[model samples]
Target chain A: MKTDQEGAVRSDALLSSWKQTPTRQAIVDYVDRALQEGGAEYVPPSERVAVFDNDGTLWCEKPMPPELGFILQRLAEMAEQDPSLRTRQPWQAARDKDYAWLGDVITKHYHGDDSDVRVLMGGILQAFAGMSVDAYAEIADRFLRTTPHPTLGRQLWRCTYLPMVELLRYLEANGFTTYIASGGDRDFMRPVTEELYGIPAERIIGTTAGLRYQDDDTGGSVVYQAEMEVFDDGPTKPVRIWSRVGRRPVVAGGNSNGDIQMLRYAGQPSRPGLRLLVLHDDEEREFNYTAGAETSLEQARAQDWTVVSIKNDWATVFADEV
Target chain B: MKTDQEGAVRSDALLSSWKQTPTRQAIVDYVDRALQEGGAEYVPPSERVAVFDNDGTLWCEKPMPPELGFILQRLAEMAEQDPSLRTRQPWQAARDKDYAWLGDVITKHYHGDDSDVRVLMGGILQAFAGMSVDAYAEIADRFLRTTPHPTLGRQLWRCTYLPMVELLRYLEANGFTTYIASGGDRDFMRPVTEELYGIPAERIIGTTAGLRYQDDDTGGSVVYQAEMEVFDDGPTKPVRIWSRVGRRPVVAGGNSNGDIQMLRYAGQPSRPGLRLLVLHDDEEREFNYTAGAETSLEQARAQDWTVVSIKNDWATVFADEV
Candidate 1:
């Protein structure tokens, strides 16, 4: 792969060279097999769809999912500027960088107090409204360029898993429309998925805040948040997939327990399908743990799901790992 | 314009010719003038969307909106198959084409005991679901091929008001995405909209039912019904438009009172905008009416919105008429 003046590896060629590796070859083979013999004998062309979890599965999640941090930072900024935000749990936790408290805030925002997620989404959207779709893309690009993972110290976008990217391309080349079923915010992911990955904004399904349209002072339109929407992880992933995409994916993948329901939905017992779980077991190369971890891996084994050891199954993790 | 063997005129050349017309030229000049001296500028592209009521504004709505008839036929079929359907108040009235009962049934459906529009949408979707999106397109194409307005005896697709079609094309050409926000059932219009009007299914917002993803007898993915959703007409038009599209349109058009809210949403007093109402007053060329004995004209007058007389503003009502 060619290196630019900044010594950052080019994704365009790393993505192309993925086919040369046995690990990438395995993913491509499985994807091809799923496409050729996955559906019923007389299945129509439109029914083939494969969904992948973006973070951990497609990219590195060690530093934090880009959107979660971006949002947390924005929350703090908004609180510092508005002062009223500190009164709210989420905004208060965000301002303090209290990650644990932030989780509780998100939980409360979604599940507690008879709250509507739309209202939370409205707040999230209001923070970033009036920004053009192109402006969002530029922000994502700038962040990816300068920001490095806290652990790996590699450019965040380059942390995209090599093998899984191959699998995505293989599935797409075979007529499977790939969608990112991420745990990240839908609005945040939408701005950059098409540029970072091949997935379009329209097809990315994830956790979202409720948004409302607001007229700006300059007479422009913006989608502002009124509240938070459902956090599309765990069991809700499957339900949101059904609600949004209106179809069950033939193949699905995830790196941890957060994706079990999505994987289950993809590998529905009634259908012919393929499901994969990525086991982060590369301590020297990446983070590895079973217990007391952000992504619980031990539970995945109990479900009889095939766990791919990133240390063994992948020839590489991030492009800049060298 | 290319005429198919079945005597149906295509939209391609007709759209091209209409753009060059004096009425379309005037609209272009008006928008250009607005943009140049003190024209409105959209900060975000999403707000540039324009929604039009399809039946009366884009084409003829005579002999009642075609979709109302389509739903009536579907309701009759449902009642015939399940005699229990006849016991349902609205279904019984709809099955017998009881016009008087329609207002009460609809009013009750919206304001009375049964507020779920999903029940109605389920019946509509059930009538058409399992048919591939392709098969539905074919049926819609055939309908547009042979069916003509009762008064005009001209293919309904070709009966579009030339000025309005040109207006739609002009907006689209200027990078504004146009949508059909009709009070008609969303499912009924989707089948033929893309072929006849060039609007995509996702962009069409109308009355709809609740749908669920389920396995068919052969274990294939399918959209099944749970209940009826909102009917996209009257007050619900603006609400559904806001709910679905998430942006207030910069431009809106309609020919009846059902479109009043939609027009108002677009022509909000604070924003620089335009909202045009097409008044069908060409009796010799098209059916002329301001207030019908059983229509919503009084509400239209009360709103004090722009009223475009077809005989004067429109140089031609239909391609053949011109």
Candidate 2:
């Protein structure tokens, strides 16, 4: 329904934060083919699902994922209440500001070592054990808005990648339903996704803690329990994608080993799938490292998946930079 | 904003299946206020969520639920493969044409007696354990379209209440996101909801079987496991509503004891909420019984929830009949 002039204006707005590169052309071409009604690669609007990873692909995850920073405050408080907790890992790492041990948890996870990740998860689970969903949301919302990204110097939300956010807008405007399928807690990202990514709370498909609905004197409330339901990462990402959306995504974006399954699941030789693996190789503007993204990078080369170089594909790193 | 003439036309189109009764007036009043942009009862379109119980509330659930009938065929095959299984309760009940025993399971569940219901659950879980979700959906879609309701003399999809589908269409046209929160399996209802209720697969929140995303040589797929992650009934209805939708519904509809919590969850005292309880009291056109809805009817009276009488409020029962 768009005129050629109108379509060009729309394309310019979508491509504003990206340099003219094969990566942008590939993404736009895949989406355009999917939108071409009655064409070979055309998908129905109902099936035009697009999913993304939150921490690294959407924002900077250098010092730590923003969620770990939010829970680090909780860990510090827990260690204060019980001094014995100071001797344990994650809690000890938080208390002493041992950034290396904290960062190693993620790096170890990608390197097929989840021992430290499990220890960090143990502390994280007990941090918000019996809080109401609404109460936990308030804390997460405040932390996301008020605190700075550990090294980025911007408020946590403002550090989101400008090009990725524009792609979300572009896809949504073209009838693709976007979802955040992160290993981060669902309630943790839900309160701010609407403001940061233009994706609403319900569209968020992330790791979930167990919940219980109890009737109280003042109506009722659904509260979070201590149990972990689905840890949506690695092989589990595709599972959550299908479980939540009920369709295979035509497009998926991610940045590490945890994303390989989802990236592979997105595009097929027969189906119109655009798999974008964001490579954080820009040290000047943002943190640069491939410690956790080694396998993902290798697979991108072998599989011909689009590798979005932060230094090459994107002209602006953070939304605030634009 | 609609002109008065346009509004009148829309109202007439929405109300065609309903009779002019106090129940219709109650529903219309709640919706009109929700659509009133600056009114006290007005809700933002983002928060205008409406949830419904699919079995009895949206369609005829008498002569046992349609899902029970679908699974009975599965039970029959199981019984035939192992003749000893024929002696068991549900298998025996299904094989012997003992509809009373099949119906009593639901009646017993609503009456706070879950003995037979548990027996039925054991059979249902093992029925289609390791099939892919897409394969299960195909079976469900065929069964739903080809099978006739026991007494309704129409395809199972055609037996859905005309008035309820109109309500779903009307709500969607008014910018409300509608969902089906049922005790039925999520996959079973997902294949048919879009065609039957105008609701989508992603919008279905129901009892979930365990699933895994398995990668084969030809990419990967999500397959169903022989486990029920969340049996969405009773108090857990509100739990799934929060887990999937992440927002309290402003409007809800139901017909059984399983739906009581969700109906109560909708429409808080401060926020705008309208709860509708459909009472199946018509015998000549449709089967009538209060065995499963006793507490629901009592609570509807005590809690001041609107009770929609099938005999009085609806001008038509089925779309096929209309």
Please tell me which predicted candidate would have the highest TM-score against the true structure: 2
> Which stretches of candidate 2 lie above 4 Å from their native place?
A1-9, A82-84, A268-270, B1-9, B81-92
Indicate the residue-level lDDT of A52 in model 1: 81
lDDT of 2 by residue, B1-322 (tens): 5322333356668878999889988877777777776678878888899999998899888777788888898889889899998999688887787888887787778888989877888787788877888798998999988888877778787889999999888888777899999988888899989888888889998888888877865567788777777789988999899888888898999988888888888866667688999998899778787777889889899888999999999999987542
Residue-level error in angstroms, candidate 1, position B115? 8.4
User: Which candidate number maximizes DockQ?
Assistant: 2
lDDT (10s digit) by residue, model 2, range A66-158: 888888888988998899999998889888888888878888888899898788887877888778888998999999888876666778878
**DockQ for candidate 2, C-alpha atoms:** 0.65
Superposed by TM-score, candidate 2 places the C-alpha of residue B170 at a distance from the truth, in angstroms, of 2.0
In candidate 2, position A115 carries an lDDT of: 93
List chain B TM-scores, each candidate.
0.71, 0.95
DockQ for every model comes to 0.12, 0.65
The C-alpha stretches of model 1 lying farther than 4 A from their native spots are: A1-50, A74-96, A100-148, A154-178, A198-200, A213-279, A289-309, A312-316, A319-322, B1-21, B27-53, B77-88, B103-184, B215-278, B284-322
Residues B1-322 of candidate 1 have per-residue lDDT tens digits of 2212211122333345443445444455434433342334322344467888887788777656666555666678778888888977446766887866554444454333344344554456666655543344455556556666666777666777776766676666555678888877665576566656677555677765544334333323324344454556666676556544545677888876667556766744544456667777788988876542123344445554455677766656677641
